[model samples]
Target: MKHKIALITGSTSGIGLGIAEAFAAKGYNIIFNGLEENGSEIARKVAGQHQVDFLFSGANMLQPEALREMVAQGTEKFGSIDVLINNAGIQHVAAIEDFPEEKWNAIIGINLTAAFHLTKAVWPNMKAQKFGRIINIASAHGLFASEFKSAYVAAKHGIVGFTKTAALEGAPYNITANAICPGYVKTPLVEKQIADQAKAHNLPENEVVKKVILAKQAVKDFVPVSTIAELALFLASENATTLTGAALPVDGGWSAQ
Candidate 1:
């Protein structure tokens, strides 16, 4: 991937940042996206660290036009995109009776529909170049349902189906599409979920984390960011061209059960 350009969405922090760092470590020029200004700064730093060209774009993925513009701007700067990681997503949990309609819309718009739009926008470019790697950061929730996380589960499941269909379509073009489904990863996003669980269960953070998040996993431990990052790196590499349409689970045996 040494002169190839990869675009990873929502890369300011968390799993997206991990994937970006992994790609940078492999000498791939990266186009980083986030709604925050800090994303660009981080891209500059990572590019410098890796000694590769880096591009940044700030766009709210919820808007279709913004998503298109983000891809356009990145391509204008980087020439062509060789890989795309659709890693931008949000999570909201609430009982069916109390779930906010707006929250549902926001979660689906960002987590599911945004990937669709971005992939559509990049499809022609990948086809034209006759090469692409598309990886979506789904979750264990995608394969298993959890109470009070209706929208998140639905969106992720949708992503898995979307990934398989995309993989089939891109196969003829030599483009590979896959999804990475992970369990509890200790990112700030999952940290927020732990905090919310603690408050809702009226338990200490540790107990809430142990009994709620890690208890379901066979290994019963939080997955490291490096695990997911390495998975993304493998999917982005030339060796993985044959490994498309897979919803690979990196959930410490959570989904295996």
Candidate 2:
């Protein structure tokens, strides 16, 4: 059997990179999309380690045309995209009243609208193939809320709704669409948040993480990128055919509250 192909956006680092590693380990050819800097080198390393084909595209998710071209290029290179992981995201911290217009637009563009564009770009091929996996990397904020995160919260909630819609549409075609909502993962994004929170709260970074960041989380621990990657693997597996339209939380019990 021919190996499957996975196209993961923002896969040069963080949660996206983690998911790419997981899929590559399972022998899926990878098409990584992110910044051009070091993207090819990362792809080469992953391909070498897993003995699977890898490609990289520096497609700016904020540009709809670029996103479409990315999907087109990946499909042309790998025949078809069996899995699409919408993992690209950006963040801005500000109250609703203070949120800059450009910042709001950019966050919505990258975090939410980009997923819509990529899924639309891939839908036809997925429908024809009668198989696809669409996984959106959402956040616990999608379910809950936090201060100084109006744009992030709104975008994440949008992702959950989008995942549900995609799931329903793809159900008959054996495609699954799901969202993974993680809470305070130990990624660059979260590290930046820790610092910002510390500054905003006038607390030390450790205090910001423990007292402020993890305060609402029952387990009071950061979710691991590896754990999220494992969940993505399961969602992409045949076993998850019946698991579409779901928002699964890996938030150290944060959403349980």
Candidate 3:
């Protein structure tokens, strides 16, 4: 009964999946959201393995009503949601002029605006409880820039700004908010980006990895999903009360450069 509930978006795959497993392993009941067709099964398997409670929602990030409904359902089932992780995101790589308007809109809608909607939906419950944690999964691009990724970078930068504002508003209510800026992780999304980058730069995929994909990171390795998950666990802990309103980088020294 003392266990808390955590609602994580995009939990069916990639970094979100890793984080969900971590939370469940810690006995945090999970509300998982993702667009993947098998998202429910994935959520169930993880929760079952960890012996934790869970609910799965196939809510598209662009749909505000659906996101709020998911929150309401989770709260109804769990009594209250203790944490929210805005981890669902999409990306596209193209020069500013060549970037499709529709692509830009979708990127901003899914990556940036969706976080706002989810946070707002969860705010009243957290405020009443006087305890909450909000974690935004931003990117290394949030701290810097890369050519041919205008929409993705812009949206991630927006996420960082949104995190700060949420932190300020949630301060009095003990609802801490922070953004995690990660270097590239070898997710399906990153794999797609690598392919796109290879084509864009007219280089072999291996060369693109060394020269373009990993060029910014001094460590020259993908950031581990587990590392990001661990930091999120820390931020969601009671000990992290004083750690709000910051964009902590987990970008393998990419941000240092």
In the range 1-257, model 1's lDDT, one tens digit per residue, is: 33888889998898898888888988888888887757778989988998988888888888899889988987888888888899988876668788899999998999999999999999999999899988999999889998878999999999999999999999999999999999999887788888777766678997987798888899978889899999888898889989999999988899778
lDDT of 3 by residue, 144-221 (tens): 989999999999999999999999999999999999999999999999998899888888988988899999899989
Model 2 residue 54 CA deviation in Å: 1.1
Model 3 CA deviation exceeding 4 Å by range = none
TM-score for each candidate, following the candidate numbering: 0.96, 0.98, 0.99
Q: Write the per-residue lDDT of candidate 2 for residues 140-194, one digit (tens) a residue.
A: 9899889999999999999999999999999999999999999888888888888
Best by lDDT: 3
Candidates in order have lDDT scores of: 0.89, 0.91, 0.94
Query: Candidate 3: what lDDT?
Result: 0.94
**Model 2 lDDT vs. the true structure?**
0.91
Off by over 4 Å in 1: none
Ranking of predictions according to lDDT: 3, 2, 1
Could you report the Cα RMSD, in angstroms, for every candidate shown? 1.3, 1.0, 0.7
Error of 2 at 59 (Å): 0.4
Order by TM-score, highest first:
3, 2, 1
Q: What is the lDDT of residue 228 in candidate 1?
A: 93
